[model samples]
Each structure stands twice: as structure tokens, then as C-alpha cells.
Target: MQVTLKNFTKTFDDTTVIDSMNLAVNDGEMLALLGPSGCGKSTTLFAICGIHRINGGQILFGDRDVSDVPSQKRNVGVVFQNYALYPHLTVFENIAFPLSVRGDSKPDIEREVRAIAALTHIEELLARRPAQLSGGQQQRVALARALVRKPDVLLLDEPLANLDAKLRLEMRSEIRRIQLETGITAILVTHDQVEAMSMCDRIAIMNKGEILQIATPTDMYRAPVNKFVAGFLGNPPIVMLEGRTSGDGRFLVKEGTSLPLPARLAGMPGDTPLSLGVRPEHFGAAGANRVEGTISFVEPQGRETLFDVTLDDGVVLRSIQPARDDVVFGQKVVWPLDAEKLLAFDVSGRAV
Candidate 1:
């Protein structure tokens, strides 16, 4: 189903949860609503599911307006954080519960349940109860249950939150595969930037009941609309340094280290204060542009090393190297900062 949220708003005793939020999920595409807790990501999902009443605006499913529809009638499949499975019920029964509720026949339910179980690769565990299965297996059962209904929309509320790191990675791929294979429009609510970036076609970054930016993961990462979005989306996070334009129209980072402003940015109004941002991975020793700093810390991650450098002006920046080095802490290094990889944000936090 193609879902649309137009000027949607929700309130709890005059405190608005979702304020004039507008977003659309194309048919068969997975849209991830990503943000930290109390940022209104889950509230938006609940508002769409009719669990929370809207104070204003419309929610549409295709051409129909379902803003006032009851939750039971929306034909939306929900997979909750806890898996919400019946302890006594076996996998087969759990997968068939939705069909049985709609009065599907036993033979038909069996066929549908088997199909979904096979699709989720849980066919062998059909006879096992919830307690007998691992967390990932239980998660698959929950997914199968939600899919058995063949609902118009699918809503996943942190469905993989309970799994371990390895399982979470595994399930992320599995969920993406299922979405592609079934061609079902899905809304995924997650706080994990990695999961959202890896699995969804587009991600909406939310904070304090508002969406900061919406774009494909690459755009959101490579070209964030503002400082908040830029700082919030990355893994080790983007390193930001206080910088300003010199009288000569050159961009000088900390310690009066002036670099010629890009020709394109020379048109910007004079006396603009800019914050320089650099991603850890973007720093390379091969680049001509170099920043002088002493290694404050080194974090080894097997395949890569994260080096935190304290510049001459007390600014700390992080850079990623291919692997751990013999360089000790407090060692001085001339790290290359790619000028093209640098991002600038104005005083208002908007990208410049």
C-alpha cells in the first residue's frame, strides 16, 4: 500500500507529539522513521495505526482517507518489539492466528501458514512453542504472523531490538529480503542508524517531534541538510571544528590555518561564520591538505583504526586508518584533511 501522512499532528493534553509531519511511502518501498527516544518516531507509527487519535491532518492509504478508521479495520500488520507471541502456541498456530481471526478455514490457514513459514525459513520450527525457539527464530515467527495476513501495510516497531549484535545484522538482511520479495510497503521505526541506513530505501530523521530531513541513506550521510542531521546519522559521528572566513576570503580552521575557499563558496556573503566538518573515513594520509595534531587516542577495530587527534588549537578530530599502527599516543602526525570532503554549517546550523 502507498501510505501518506499529510500535515499530521497529534497531541497529548496540548503537548503536540507529531507536528505538521508530512511523509509518503511509495508502494513496495520500505521507509524508516529514525530518531532517538521521544522524538515522535513511534508516535507517528501509532497515529497511523489508529492506536493514537490525531489532533489534526489526514492519513491516507492509497486513495482512501483512514484518519478516522478504527485500528481493527485498517488492515495494517504490526510487529511489536517484544514479538508478542503466545507462549503456549506453537509456531504453526502463531502464524495462523491472524488468518483464524479473519475466519479463514483450517485447510486455507495451513497452506498460508506453511507458505509464510517457508518464506521466513521457519518451516522446521512449526511444531515448536515460542519458548523452544531462539530470539531470532521467535522474531521470524512474529514476521510470519504479520505477513500471513497479507495486509495492505506493514509496520515494524523495533522488531529486532531483542537480538544480539550478530543476530541483529542477520535479521536486518532477512527483513530487507522479505520486503523485496513480498513487494509490501513497510514502515520501520528504529533508533539504530546502521539498520535504517542499510535496509531502507529512504530514512526520515526525526528529533523533538519534528523531521529534520528526509532522503536516501547516501544523501542523508554524504550531504546532510544541517548540523543536527549530519552529527546524528554517522557511526563514530562527524568531527566538527570551529572555523570562520578570514578577511582575505579564505576559510581558516582553528589556529589560523587558512585554506583557500572553494571558488563556488567565494560567492557566499562576506563575514559568514562556518563550522568545518570532516568524517573519520574521509581523512587520508595521501591528500595534499594536511592538519597538524597529536594523537590523543587510538581505537583498533580489527580492520580499521580510529585515531583521535588534538590539534594545535585544542580542537579534537578523528580520522580512520586502514589498520592499527605502531604510532603511540602523544605522537605527532600530519593527517591529511580532504578539502572536498569538508562540510560547512553556518551559525544557524544549516549547511552552507
Candidate 2:
């Protein structure tokens, strides 16, 4: 199913939660709505599932408008954060519940339940109740139940948030596999950047009830539209520093630090106040066009070491290097900035 939201609007007592939000989940594509709490991601999901009514615009499943359809009639399967399984029901019974609700024959329900259980690898746990299952097991049961109905669309609301780190990783792969196998158009609402980037085909970055940018994981990382999108999508987060473009095609970082501006930015106005954004990995050993700084902190992260370096003007920046590199706190070091990889933003936060 290709689910489309056209000018979707949702409000509560004069407060708008989703303001003219428009998005589309392409057929069989797994899209993720990612943002912080109160960013309207969950609300947008609910609106699509008909749990929250929209104030304006249309909700289309393919070409048909289902904006006013009731939640139960939407044919959208939902797997919530808590699993929401019935504790008293066995896994088989729980998976069969959705089919049984619409008065399917006993034998047909049994056949569908078993098939879904097999697909989810929970066939052996058919007789077990929710309490007897581990968090991951319960999650699988929930997924099976959702798939048992063979919904055209699947909605996951932080479905793996309650699991442990290892379990979360496992479920991420599990969910992706199932979505691909079933070819269901799915939307996942999550705040975890890694989960979204790892699972979804495309990610919709949201903030303050509006979509900031929607793109493939690689594109969103390499070319964010603005400061918010750039800062929100990285693991350690992009380091941002105040700077200005000097008259001589140079980007001035601080009192005595500057690097030649890339030719692509030759048209930028001289003395333009800007924010310089760079990933930690973009800094390297001292060479041409490098700047000097004193290390303030060092953290060894298995394969890589993270260094907190402070410049002469009190500006601090982070750099990541191979763990084998000998680095010590309080020692002076120099690292060249990758001019081509540098991102520049105007005072308004728009990428320059």
C-alpha cells in the first residue's frame, strides 16, 4: 500500500500538533518518522491509523481517500511500544484474535496463525502465554499477530524501545526482514537515530510538529538541508562552531585560525557570519591548512579514540582518530580540516 497524507492537520485546544504535514509512504517501502518527544511523530502515526482524527486534508491508501474512516476499518496493523498482547491468551490465540474478530472460520484462522508464527519463528511458543515469553519473544508474538491479519500497512510505534541493547539490535533486523518478505508498506515512529537509519528505506526528520527533511539515510547524513537536520542525524552529532568568511576566500574559525574555502563556496559574501559544521572524523593529523589545539579530554572507543581539543581562543572541538594514535590530554596537537566536507550555515540556520 502507498499511504499518503495530504496537508494533514491535527490540533488540540488551539495547539497544533501536526501542521499541514504532508508525507507519503511508497508501496512496500519502510519509512521512519524520527524525532524527539513532542515532535508530533507519534501523533502523525496515530492520525494515519485513525486513532487521532485529522482536522484537515486527506489520508489516502493508494488512490482511495480514507480520511474519515474509523480506526478498525483502516486495515492497518499496529505494533505498539509495549507489545499490547493479552496476558491470558496463548501465542496462537493472540495471533488468531484479529482474524477471529472478523468471523473467519476456525480452520482458516488456525492455518493463518500457524503460518505467521512460523514466519516470525515463534511456532514453538504457540502454547505459551505472554508472561512465559521474554521481551523479544513477546515482541515476535506481537509482530506475528499483526502480520496474521495480512494488513496492507504496518505501523510500528517504537516497537523495540523496551528491549535490551542486544535484543533491540536483533529485532531491528527481524522487523526489516519481515517487512521485506511481506511487502507491506510500513511506517516506524522512533527517536533512536541508529534504529531508523538501520531499518528504514527513508527517514523523515521531524521537529516542532513539522517535517524538516526526508531522505535516504546516506543522503540525509552527507547533505542535510539545514543545521537542525545535520545535527539531529549523526551518532556523536556534528560539531558546530561560529565562523565567518574572510575577504581572501578563507573561513576564519577564531583569532588566528582559518582555512581556505572550497571553490564551490566562492560566491559566498566576504565577512559573512556563518556556522561551520564538521563531523569528528573530518579532522586529521597536522598538515597544510591545519589548525592547532590543546587536548582537553580523550576517550578510547574500541576502534576509534575521541579527543576534545580546545583552541587558543577557548573554542572547543571534537575529533576522532584511529585508536592506535597516541594522544594525551593537555598535549598540543594539530589537525587539518576537510574543506570539501565542511558545511556552512548562515545566521538563519539555513545551509549556505
Which 10-residue span in candidate 1 carries the lowest summed lDDT?
A: 255-264
Which pairs of residues have clashing backbones in candidate 2? none
Off by over 4 Å in 1: 247-249, 254-263
Model 2 spans with C-alpha error above 4 angstroms: 254-256, 285-288
- What lDDT is obtained when candidate 2 is compared to the true structure? 0.89
Give the best candidate by lDDT: 2
Q: Write the per-residue lDDT of candidate 2 for residues 89-119, one digit (tens) a residue.
A: 9989999999999999999998999889888
Q: How far is 111's C-alpha from truth in model 2 (Å)? A: 1.0
Backbone clashes for every candidate come to 0, 0
* Tens digits of per-residue lDDT for model 1, 202-269: 99999999989989999999999999899988879998777777756468775666654555576666
